[model samples]
Target: MRLTHFRHSCVLVEMSDTRVLFDPGTFSQGFEGLTGLDAIVVTHQHPDHIDPVRIGALVDANPDAQLFADPTTAAARGDRWIAAVPGHDYGIGNLIARAVGGVHAVIHPDMPTIDNTSILLGDEERIGRFYHPGDALFVPDVPVDVLGLPVNAPWCRISETIDFFRAVSPTVAVPIHDELLSPEGAAIYLARLTDMRPDGADLLRWEAEATQEF
Candidate 1:
């Protein structure tokens, strides 16, 4: 599998002859003009997770790509958007995307939690699995090969971030959902996360917009 981080939470995963992009939000870049994608998966409806302004253009460009998002976002994002319900699987090329989490993390007590489905991509033969948890910390039952870790967020703290990384224990964990942090702040967070990551798990930070094989 190949992974490309496009700033913030947006990432492009190429595996099993399929190209799938996750969370082309307001903070992400370089995904607007992508074509020939097998699927576009959105974990939640937050503006940072799904840019309402530029998403139409992206969808228009990849007309053949399947659109998948949480139920509410799917219902509102035209008829083509499919809801990623928990326990359900969506086929994308040679991989199967299984939806796990059904709710987003709470930003605050007063704010209502929304739908957030963590998508796990794996082939039928069980070769490898790539997990994108979006904005939630929900862990899947199966082992993960690569993890898109949300290192910083409004609803997340450094301790929770460390715990999540440890719990997942993926072979590789890459930081995501980090648009709010400055370079220095990101360095601090990354250092801590790297230091506390589980044994045998590598914390990798791929260069933005560049693809690297995993």
Candidate 2:
């Protein structure tokens, strides 16, 4: 599988001859050369997580691509898109996906409308999970190959991120949701990840415009 970090929480995952774009927000870039997107997954309705304008552009570019999102997000699309919920599994071509519930944060208990999810994608032989926690801080029990975790959000403290990393224990933990932070903040957070892991989980940092193959 190939993973490309566009910016902020937006990521493009390519596997099984399919390209799945996750959380194409307003600030995300690097979609100029992308074509034939098989699926688009939106974790929530947050402005930094879902940009209908960009999604419309993507759909216009790839007519066959399907959109999978929660109920609120699907309604925002105003089209006949696929509706997905926690624990639901669906298959598209060679890619199989399972949805898991996630949290928005500890501070926003009143705004539960912003639902979050983690997507697991793979086949029978080898399973690969990409946990896009959206604005969530909860750590799931399931094991994952690659975890796209939010390192710094408005509601998350540095200690909270460390605790999340310790609980999830993913093979490779890539930091996201740190766009508003300074370069020094990111560096410090990365360094903290290096020191906090008890099992020495692989720390992967995604560059704004770079892509990594798993």
Candidate 3:
């Protein structure tokens, strides 16, 4: 599969002719040229993960492309969105996606936690399993081939991020939700994370506007 990282949590996962877009938030750019998208998987309703106006435009443009997200996100988007059922697989072209992770990570005692939906894309054999755990640290029960890892976020810590990576031990880790720091800073942190990987997993540096195949 080929992965195109625009910015932040937006990564277009393309396998052959079928393409699935994740996030497409305010922090993520490079949408002017995006066309023929098969599916858009929104992990949460946070502005950095899903921009309603921007996504509405995209959805309008790509009328055939489906919008899958958590209940909160679906509700926020009204009739245009489809809420994902946890553990239930939905077919998107050649790929099958199962929703996982329900609630968002705790920000603080006073702040309200929102809905977060992490998705796993693959078949039963897990040959091309790709997991994108939106804004939280979600550890899937099965083996993963490609993982979209959040390097930095308000609810994420480096220690927990490292632990999540260690737990999943994916063959390739794709950094996401990282518009808060410069490219240099993100690289430095990822380099350190590479050294600390438990399974010697490859930290694929997803460059903006470039398509990377794995």
Candidate 4:
């Protein structure tokens, strides 16, 4: 599998002869002009996660690609969007995806928790399994070959962030959701991962927009 990180949480996972784009949001933009994607998976409805208007335009541009979203996003987008059902597997082209998680991490006590879904995509032996947990540090129950870790966010602390890696136990960890960080801050977060990642798991170090093969 090949993973390419965009500006923030937006990542393009190329596996099994398929290109799956996750979270093409306001922080990310290159995907809009691309075509022939196998699937576009949105984990939630937050602007940083969904970017409805921009995604809508991308959908219009790439009619052949399938749009999979969590309930809230699917509902708002109407029939065109397919709701990602928890525990249900979706076969789109060469990729098979399973939806995980139900709600976004709460921003604060006063703020209501919003709907969210983390997607695990891969086939029986295709690039192992890759999970992209949108805004939250959701760890899938199954084995993960590559984990899209949210390095920094409002709802997570450095300790909980490390705990997430421990729980999932992915073979390779990749940092995401880092658009808000300065170069120095990102370096600190990367150092934390280096110092505390689970045993035997490799952390891929690549700049944004660079590709890493697993």
Residue pairs that clash (backbone atoms under 3 angstroms), model 4? none
Tens-digit lDDT string for candidate 4 (96-178): 89887878987899998988888889886753389998877777767888998888888888898899988888998888888
Tens-place lDDT per residue, model 2, 6-63, is 8888888888788888888887787645678888888877777777567677778877
User: What are the TM-scores, per candidate, against the unseen true structure?
Assistant: 0.97, 0.91, 0.94, 0.95
Report lDDT per candidate.
0.90, 0.76, 0.84, 0.84
Q: Number of the top candidate by TM-score? A: 1
Ranked by TM-score, top first:
1, 4, 3, 2
Cα lDDT of model 3 by residue, 1-214, tens digit: 8888888889888885689999988998987467788898899989888876688788877888888998888887777688986777788888888888888888787999888988998766673478998877878788899998889887877888899999989998988877898879887888878888867688887677678878
Residue 122 displacement (Å), model 3: 1.3
**Residue 104 deviation, candidate 4, in Å?**
0.7
RMSD of 2: 1.9
Total clashes in model 4, counting residue pairs 3 or more apart in sequence or in different chains: 0
Model 4 segments beyond 4 Å from truth? 125-128
User: Which one wins on lDDT?
Assistant: 1
> Can you write out model 1's per-residue Cα lDDT over 1-214, one digit (the tens) per residue?
9888888999999997999999999999999889999999999999888999999999999999999999999998777999999999889998999999898988899999889999999987652389999989998888999999998999999999899999989999988988899989999999999989999999997667877788
Q: Is 2 or 3 the stronger prediction by lDDT?
A: 3
